[model samples]
Target: MDLKVDPEEMDCNQPVPVEVFASRSTLHGLSHILTYERICIKRCLWILFFMGSLSFLVCVCVDRVQFYFEYPHVTKLDEVSAPVMIFPAITVCNLNSFRFRSVTRNDLYHAGELLALLNRRYEIRDPHLVEESVMETLKFKADFHNFKPRPFNMFEFYDRTGHDIKDMLLACHYRGMECGAENFDVVSHRLSETHNLILASSHAGEP
Candidate 1:
């Protein structure tokens, strides 16, 4: 069989391996052999060096291949017993964070508007550009400038703006028994800056 390489869908081209290899190959010894320089011992040494290097490379490849399939531990299913499951706390926060109906007009105008504006401070160019209702809120009906804010009460403020657990739980039963807001604990949410309230199942210790 002819060893000459064939070009795809083109004329078959025969490349002289010895001549091409000598010209293009990076190997130093092969060129010397091609040039016919009378150094028999040097040629022998190059051959032995290449054979030994090939053997070493092959051994390294085989070793790595053998180690590739090796695992630290075998994977197998094992049965394990787990007892005493604790009830998880589910946080129930109001979709509408601030309840306008619960909050007083004055508080909504002064503190509520302030809170709303504070959230959108970076986004708004002018306070006048804000919603007409919000602008009207800032502008007092009796007096334009005079706006008195109430005393800061953490619990009271949260109670006014945030939703109550009692209002949410119309009907709830824990383990076939009647349950109410008393079963849950009131907690401040992170998103509300600890000013708004959220309901969570009180840790009763049993699931």
Candidate 2:
């Protein structure tokens, strides 16, 4: 068979098969794979992240609901007196380590006892901790201040009290050192004067 081809159609450099066109059109190279695959992978990752974020939000809401329902009686403040008025104002002055602004009497008593223990055992004190512990006790105040509470004005309190709460804590820490507690000084270094005072005053009455 004489298969004579036209000169215009017979470019010797050109590939003869239709597969040449198909191969060129298909994405077979590394560049093609990277460009196409990257977009697909990124889209899948974003979807997964979105799902995880939504699930986390749902979990937080569920926890809040559970807490509110579980402690309905504790949330009630109608019978609870004003923490500022009921608790001795003198104790509220310098303690910053303790959360005290909106606590109940029961909490205050508990904190006071704890403070007394720290003082009696280690000769330590921190007024701020005592005050904070007081606030922790008062249901209404503590719950209200559960978010960001007003910061204690330490300088103002210190000036009014004429007692350096830090000094009191340091004195206790020295006592702890005598008992071979190396960590006591480190704790005292971290806490402010107010905190030290609270530790000192925590357990003054109970034997």
Candidate 3:
């Protein structure tokens, strides 16, 4: 007996299926989608980070602006019935050499007496030292925050008369003078107020 073989049946042994190709194409599409999603997530995270940094910067700026604008309450010496006497540690800068020295109550009192004498038109034997003392006293008072009035220009007063507070004090020591009441009164009053404030602040920290 002789057997007959078909040519199409031999080709069908290596047949390619449509389902395998479809599954491979589907896997490529899913991979592309996953990559796109990862990029989107990264962009969202970066945006959020930038926004947080911007928000912090804005908050800091606002807080600094508020701090600069706001003024703390300062109690006047006259407001207290009996003002406490406090000798705060003062650093005095010498005008000639620009050297600094620690000032004591004695130094202040001596300067005040000299100021009083100048107010009374009494001649100062050592005008130079007296001038130095007055400048140091003024500088010490100025060190205390808000002791002087706002827009207080020290240079303006200094430029008027050889940068000498002594001359200014001598000229306007008496009442009805060109600059009104004695400059010593202004200095003393401010000094007293500054002293009281210092005392109050020091005692505030006490138990």
Each model's total of backbone clashes: 0, 33, 0
Candidate 3 TM-score versus the reference: 0.20
Model 1 steric clash pairs: none
| lDDT (Cα atoms) of all candidates against the true structure | 0.57, 0.41, 0.39
Q: How many residue-pair clashes does candidate 1 contain?
A: 0
The TM-score of predicted model 1 comes to 0.37
Q: Is candidate 1 or candidate 2 better by TM-score?
A: 1
> Who is ahead in lDDT, 2 or 3?
2
Candidate 1 Cα deviation (angstroms), residue 9: 50
C-alpha TM-score for every candidate:
0.37, 0.18, 0.20
Cα displacement (angstroms), candidate 3, residue 26, comes to 41
Task: Compare the candidates by TM-score and give the number of the best one.
Answer: 1
Who wins the lDDT comparison?
A: 1
Per-residue alpha-carbon lDDT of candidate 2 for residues 64-178, written as tens digits (9 for 90 to 100): 9998889765454567557564211222233444433333333333343452423442222454655654433433432322344344444343343343444333322233232
Report the C-alpha lDDT of model 1 over 1-207, residue by residue, as the tens digit.
877645652443555567567867797556755645687887788778877878998999999888887845778999876675344434555666666455554554445445564233222236666777655544443232465755665456656677667776677655566656666766554336433332343446422
Candidate 2 runs further than 4 Å off: 1-38, 72-207
